[model samples]
Target chain A: MDLDILINSLRNYDGITRKNFIRGATQILDETYNIGGRTALGFGDDASALDIGNDTLLLMAADGMWGRLIEGDPRWAGYCSVLVNVNDIAAMGGVPMGMTNVISVNKEDICNEIMLGIKEGVEKFGIPMVGGHIHPDTPYTALDVSITGIVGKDDVITSCGAKIGDSVIIGMDLDGRQHPKFPLNWDTTSHKTPELVQSQITVMNSIAKKHLLTAGKDISNPGILGTLGMLLEASGVGAIVELEKIPRNKKVSWDEWLKVYPGSGFVLTSKEENVKECIEMLQEVNITSQVAGIITEDKKLNLRHDNQEKVVFDFNHDIIMGIKEERS
Target chain B: MDLDILINSLRNYDGITRKNFIRGATQILDETYNIGGRTALGFGDDASALDIGNDTLLLMAADGMWGRLIEGDPRWAGYCSVLVNVNDIAAMGGVPMGMTNVISVNKEDICNEIMLGIKEGVEKFGIPMVGGHIHPDTPYTALDVSITGIVGKDDVITSCGAKIGDSVIIGMDLDGRQHPKFPLNWDTTSHKTPELVQSQITVMNSIAKKHLLTAGKDISNPGILGTLGMLLEASGVGAIVELEKIPRNKKVSWDEWLKVYPGSGFVLTSKEENVKECIEMLQEVNITSQVAGIITEDKKLNLRHDNQEKVVFDFNHDIIMGIKEERS
Candidate 1:
């Protein structure tokens, strides 16, 4: 596919469009986000960090399954609930401790399927799903999972730490196929062994501890380039990507690949000196990693392929989440 | 009301009835509740406890607002989400760190009102709502909030620690009226200063640190007697209480008071020697306190008034949550 077509498709993707809604809700929450002085990093990050003293920080994040996804397949929705929340913690380079979920369902069958899926995901991720509330008689089915993790105060990775001289790394366990029910969901962890699946997360912790990555975020529904845009927006920087260098399975088409929410994918920024080691660590865990782009002082993401270039996101005017980290 | 009548009424209360739905969901989750081994107290508790090392444990809990409450008053629903989750951590005698929420809304007005309510709650509780996900196009509106707190591993309290002969104390801030739309909601914190409302939580932390309580729980949707029944079930014990000794607002009828979800109400168990101090500390925060009962060896909760005693919950036959904490 041509650069212009791929850029336009991703720019108009529903995954990106849906994020605009966050701005309104967050605006109302803006004042109270830092009500307590212990908030180390509040909104605009994969997880909010709270200082608990003793050089330890607690990480918290929540994600809700889309109604469409839940309606299509409750089991996938349940499994994805864990995957998404776990990835949120993993992106922050924290050790995910546990998760709690709130599920609303009217049917027993659907509830059972979802719970089984969650059980599978929990086993695969190696994180306990300890406790949560169940709204048993809601008119619709929905699942929201929240995760908590811990990281050293100094070893934390955040979305707003990217710098102009950094290299943008795109990593994904590309040996997987798309989910049967949800085409956008690239299923990587399900077929893999539990030990291998968990390494995708622990590898990030090792990266964080070594101070390898300047900023990182999981490739979620917003996909690779879109997720990168969010990190850039938070960091007040931009990137110029050689589109062909982005690691992807050859089986998937370009438009679909750009929007696929992989089971294990991450977009990270690291100093040029740290790129080799960071990619090596991720590769050791079976994640295909490569330096696909370079961070730039200009606040726009420029995509290049086949001697052609196109501007996909201009942070100066575009609003992915319309948020900038409130640094504590 | 007669003892038998009240017993029957509470047994059939909707708050308690709704809990039955949790049985099916939890039964499925039981197998994996302690999958990661880090869970110190999994399931069957107000908050799940996970050992995070350094003599500190992490507490996690989630609560979803009832659809009826959301429909009745979105603002109150939003505020209650925070109140409920914070109380979960407080009930565990932990210091609440932060909360995250997932809100699903299709209407802009309802969304704004809910956010406003959440903002008010965040400010009142003095705990931040750091991060969350928003589903803007759901067919139905809902809100789920999850919280994390920290407590010394040795100092943490659990519902399953009630020992025979422990005094059962019912503590509540009776200086409140019923909510206009939700009569069972005893609205206490909204009118109070942030300091006083926060004291309601910090007092629990103090109690935990002092090791004065054997078992404790916040009075939530299941109300006073129903909540106490849960504590008894978890501890593999029972209680005999004098109904009149239960701290209650004189203005509310006995039936309503027994079923009211108090803003700051707790059913606690403490050794006889520590009961006086526990009550005094709770009372210092305007939470009216009294020793209403004694934990018993029998597996049933017996209620007494005017020499007439009747069993309220037969643990052998009744299952409030159908969960037994996997104590690690």
Candidate 2:
């Protein structure tokens, strides 16, 4: 593979570029993100954390379905909505609790399909869809879901904790197919048993309690490398990842495989001494895990393949959700 | 005032009628709303409660901005989003912990204005807006916000707890004008000191801890009588309210006052013996309070004005969010 071509494709992909808006949006609330002083982590993590007393922190996250996804298949959109939110809490090493959604659709049939999909997701994830608001007469169809989870205050994982020389681990459920309608979606959980699907979530909490990883994030719309770049940006560090060492499904080419959002996938970082146990635990849960790279103090993400290396994101110049983690 | 016309206007008011879709939407998840048995209160409440251990329940609720309101005044729409979600927690007698939002807007100027409004709201209410997702390229402008709060499990005030013969109290800040852009918005907290505005919320928690109210709910888009109808529907009970006894700002006509979404307002049900103390506590926070009605066993909400009585909602036939609170 031509390293330059692959690097450019990953850097310019819409999944990665669409994140440009977050920096500007978050900057608007920079002063108040920690206004109450209880914000344990904010703005730059899979879920925001607030110190809620009793040695626990409340984790909150929200996601809006892409309009195209909603229009093409409302059911998948609704199902994916729950999938994404659950993954967010898991990425933070928190137990999934409950979710609420705001669904704006005008057609009764479409609404039912969406709700049915949500019900399936709830059953699969073992989380409740407790309460929400519905806009019955909107001119468009949209689904926005927000979730809340709890984690031990000291055990909560954050995107900003990667240290130099730490090993970068990429874990994914490879037993999946690319969704025909939405090619970027790696369909894994739908075909798996609820027992297996739920186990994937609980495993993260166990890893957190054991202090297995220094930092972690769920692979989302930004693909694997793009998501890693975000973690690097938040941590104010970087890494050199060997392309061939990354885990992949044989059916998909490297370019496409890197971009597909797997039903259960995470990019994690841990000290070299802890990497083996972390990988072993992930494998027991059926997640294909491997140490693909090493964290670096230099703020640049470099991809290497075929004895060639190309810089995908030089944080000094390239911006992806530009806000760095602000420690108080 | 013509009681029939006022009743008809409120019955058909879009704010109340728009809620018709919740029943069908929630019914889809009827089998799974309490999937894990952690759900303490699900549908038919301002916020859903889950048993989060430590004698506490985690409260979650979400609200979406009205499309027309966002189109008319994005700033006010943003501000109201926070106000509405915060009130959802307060109605359940919980301490507002934090909030997250999903903002979908295409215009930069509009997005900034909305964020400014959110920032203002965060500062005023003293609850931090910790994290959110922004959809910067959507065709429509919509803001959906969700809040997480903590409350003692035993101290929660729910809409389903109102008992027959309980006195119904309507509490609102009557010292505000109608918003210039949205006539139905009673602008209460925008001009008040944060101390007074936040006190209104903390007072609800005090009432809950003291076990002053049998049930409570924040008066929302449905206005006074319409909100009462929802509470009555949830409790499987009805009420007889004297129109003149409801505290109101004289500037707004009875027709308009009954439909305005006040920034700080609640509909509460308490035993007759607790009515005096409840009203006194509400008054201490600048919220005008008075006992305006009595709960009844009949499944109907009746309003009396000038000695003429009219049925606003007969739950036996009329459906406003048809799902009633199912106690397990």
Candidate 3:
């Protein structure tokens, strides 16, 4: 594989580039992100956390379904809406309690299909879709869902805790197929039993409670390396990832496999001593795991393959989300 | 004013009629609304509550901006987004902790204006907007916000708790003008001090702590009578409201006043014995309060003016949201 070519493709990928808008928007409200002084984590994580007293933190996150996805398949969009939000909470090592949605669609049939998909997701995850607002006369179709969860204040995992020498672990459920309609979606949970699907979710909380990882984030639209780059940016550090060590489903090529959003995937950082146990616990839940890289103090994400190394993101110049953790 | 004409206009008002779609959408997800048995309150309330242990309930609610409002004025749409979600928590007698938003816009300038409005709202309410997702390449401009708050489990004031003989109280800040861009928006908080504005929010918590009201809901897009109609519908009961007894700003005609979405307005139900204390507490925060009606067992919301009575909504026939409180 041409390391330089692969690096460039991932760097210029739309999944990663679309995140540029976030820094500008968040910068506009920078002064008040923690106005009440109870914000334990904000802006740069999978979910923000507020210190709600009682040794507990409330985690909140929101996601907007891509318009193309909604138009092409409203059912999948709605189903993924729940999938993504629940993943956000799970990524933070919190047990998601409930979700609320705002759905705007012009057709009754489409809305019903979307709701059916949401019902399936709610039952699969064991979380409730308690309340929401619907705009039935809108000219466009859209779905936005927000979720809330709770975690022990000290047990909460953040994106900014990666240390210089920590081992980078990539975990993914490889027993899945690429969704035919949306090629980048790795469909793992749809056919799985609810017992197994739910166990995959609770495993994160178990890892959190055990203090197994220093930092972690779910692999999203930005793909695996891009998501790791975001964690690096937030942590003010970088990583040296051995491309071949990364876990992958054999059916997909390296380029496409790196970009696919798996139903259960996470980029985690842990002390070398904890890596063995973390990988073991994840494997018990059917998530294939491996130590793929090491964290570095240098602010650049370097990809190694075929005895060649290419810098995918030099944080000094390349910006993805561009938000560094500011909490002391 | 002819009572029949006034009633007909309110019945067909877009704000109230738009809610009809919610029933069908919610019905599709009916079985899982309380999936995990943690849901203490679900549909038919300002905010859904989940018993998160420790005698505390986590409250959540979401709202989508009207497409026309966003098209005409993105700033107000952004500000109202926060106002509406915060009010949802306040009406549930919870302390507003934090909010998350999903903003999809095609124009940079419009996005900036909307962010500015959100910033202003955050500072004004003293509640933080900690995190959000942005869809910068969408074909339309839309904003959806969700909020999380906390209240004691035993202290929650629900819309389903109104007793048959309870007095219906209408509380609103009558010292404001209609918004220049949106005539239906009663601009109360924009010109007020943050200290006073925030006090209005906390006063509801005080009432809840004291167990002053049997039920409550914030008046939203559906003006006074329309909102009252919804409350009656949710409570599985009806009300008889004396039109003139409802506190109002004299500048707005009865027709217009009944439909304006005030920045701070609420419809509450209290026992006759607690009416004096509830009104006194509301008055402390500059919200004008009055006993406007009485809850009844008959499923009809009747409005009386100048001794002529008219049925605004016969719950047996009319369906505003059509969701009755089903929690036994």
Candidate 4:
């Protein structure tokens, strides 16, 4: 329940460890990130923005389900495919337009179950599953989903846009419980009304349109700190955050709370002048948000609470995403 | 090979046979195809088209590599992920803008190699690989890619736009050989200059802008004839194609020739007024196209060559895509 214990647990978690490889992968992809002029924002962001002209930018992102997740429950894997990709676009403050999926399966039943899940997710999110390819005879079953959305060119949020002296805020929808089947996942959207969950995504759009944040990203598998670490690394900045200031369900312990992947949550940094407006917009859609830290020029994430402070991430020494957005 | 042998070989080829499951998926998806009220063309086409306002439309498509393909050469799978999606947009007479991928792998080496291939593809195609998600822990490796393109709404091509009296034209770039690992693949772009390959894709945009084809689709896993069958099903019409009129590499046998998945080939239909312009444009890009036959009201695909005409697909009993656009 203490700070060190929670930090160690999160750092050692497989979900957090798995993201280290992203740094290396981004290194190889570094060369061709901006091959064309259409790329407004490329790697190390929840969604890449494309300059589509006419004051509009296109947001694109893709997500693949873990093979273990598919093996455990193909239907849940299918549903999560939509959920994760949608979240990626939402984090960028874009209006999701449609989705496409590629599914490979050897069994008919598994494919059917995954399709059923996709159907439900599509209905809940109000986004169409447009077009995709299917492999009927793969040795293993896997599902990957990709999404596209649109946003005004001047109003897009990006991880790499975070700046020094900005206030960092953690916003989360805490009105939910951990999924019964997936322990590390905090289930919020499934139990809530579709209208409420969708409005939660739209509220971020309102925030972006109003220029309430300098930078933002969705909280994902690496959980809150891991997600913040990636955003800071992308922006080439660091932060000193108070662990006690972060919003929590209170029922979940500190260790569990820090690592839970909430259905709707975000890590954002903005000028102090805009924090109140940002918090108010998110609150309108059921997100509880608070300023937890201030971004600094030093490339380290320092955590503080109860008159005790510890270094959680030193980006210069330990790479989280390693990708500096301007370079990537 | 004799006509019967060639027909039977094309029917049984894995590239063509695997598509038989598409109808089953469409049936399951049923009405969810048009969720946002702007899907001009859905499931049974090379790519789905969405009306994005301002006399312009967005084209979206996704493709996943076969597991065997991924296992055989992960690099090629990654490269082809871009290749296939790009071709999908080209076939629709749209200008490709960008692509995103979903990659799942347990090993760092596999991920690295795939990213290398993707980098090569981006440089070659002159398009950017914008953003995507990675599942660092998976039981097996898989790569799925999705693409978006732009087209003028009035000039867009659709699989279901073929008229009863339209001319059937099968155009393909014949300047390549079969791949070493994947024998059924016609590897055209690998050996040629990127300028030439990119020009081939751009030529489709020219055709669209000039207002040419009645119906069109990229020739994918289902080869030429099966792809034609899908077009016919979508168009609510049939055609009798002269089997001899289809462009082919004489070095490959008839059986192998009919089933090869070409790098840049398309099955297109046009009214007589547009036939000359269509063939001329296709030839400018090294795609040898000829007027093969005529579309008919009879819902059947017939193949004819040298005093021998045979019915290849009887749509009354068989369904290639099983989707009749609009069901009118």
lDDT of 1 by residue, A1-328 (tens): 6777778889999899889899888889877777878999988899999999999889999999998898898888889899999999999999999999999999999999999989989988989999999988888999999999999899999999999989999998999999888888999988899999998999999999999999999999899999999999999999999988999899998899989999999999999999999999999999999999999999999999888888999988999998887569
Local accuracy of candidate 4 as per-residue lDDT tens digits, B156-268: 87888899999999998888989999878998889878898899899988988887888888888888888898899888899998878888888887677677789889999
Question: What's the TM-score, to 2 decimals, of chain B in model 4?
Answer: 0.96
lDDT of 1: 0.92
Q: What is the DockQ of each candidate?
A: 0.87, 0.89, 0.90, 0.77
What is the per-candidate TM-score for chain B? 0.98, 0.99, 0.99, 0.96
Candidate 1 TM-score for chain A: 0.98
Question: Model 1: DockQ against the native?
Answer: 0.87
- Local distance difference test values of all predictions, in order: 0.92, 0.93, 0.92, 0.85
Write model 3 residue lDDT over B1-328, tens digit each, in one string. Answer: 8999999999999999998999988997888888878999887789999999999999999999998888898988888899999999999999999999999998899999899999999999999998989999998899999999999998998888888999999999998989998999998999999999999999999999999999999999888888888888888999999999999999999889999999999999999999999999999999999999999999999999998988999999999989888552
DockQ of 4: 0.77
Q: True contacts preserved, each candidate?
A: 0.91, 0.87, 0.88, 0.76
Q: Which should have the higher TM-score, number 1 or number 4?
A: 1
- What would the per-residue lDDT of candidate 3 be over residues A156-226, giving only the tens digit for each residue? 88899999999999999999999989889998999999889888889999999999999999999999999
Q: What is the interface RMSD of each candidate, in Å?
A: 0.9, 0.7, 0.7, 1.2
What stretches of model 1 exceed 4 Å from their correct place?
none
Candidate 3, residue A52: the lDDT equals 96
Error of 2 at A101 (Å): 0.2
Best by DockQ: 3
Specify the CAPRI tier of model 2. Answer: high
Candidate no. 1 TM-score: 0.99
Candidate 2 per-residue lDDT, tens place, A143-191, comes to: 9999999999989989999999999999999999999999899999999
lDDT of 1 at B2: 82
Question: Cα RMSDs of all predictions?
Answer: 1.0, 0.8, 0.8, 1.7
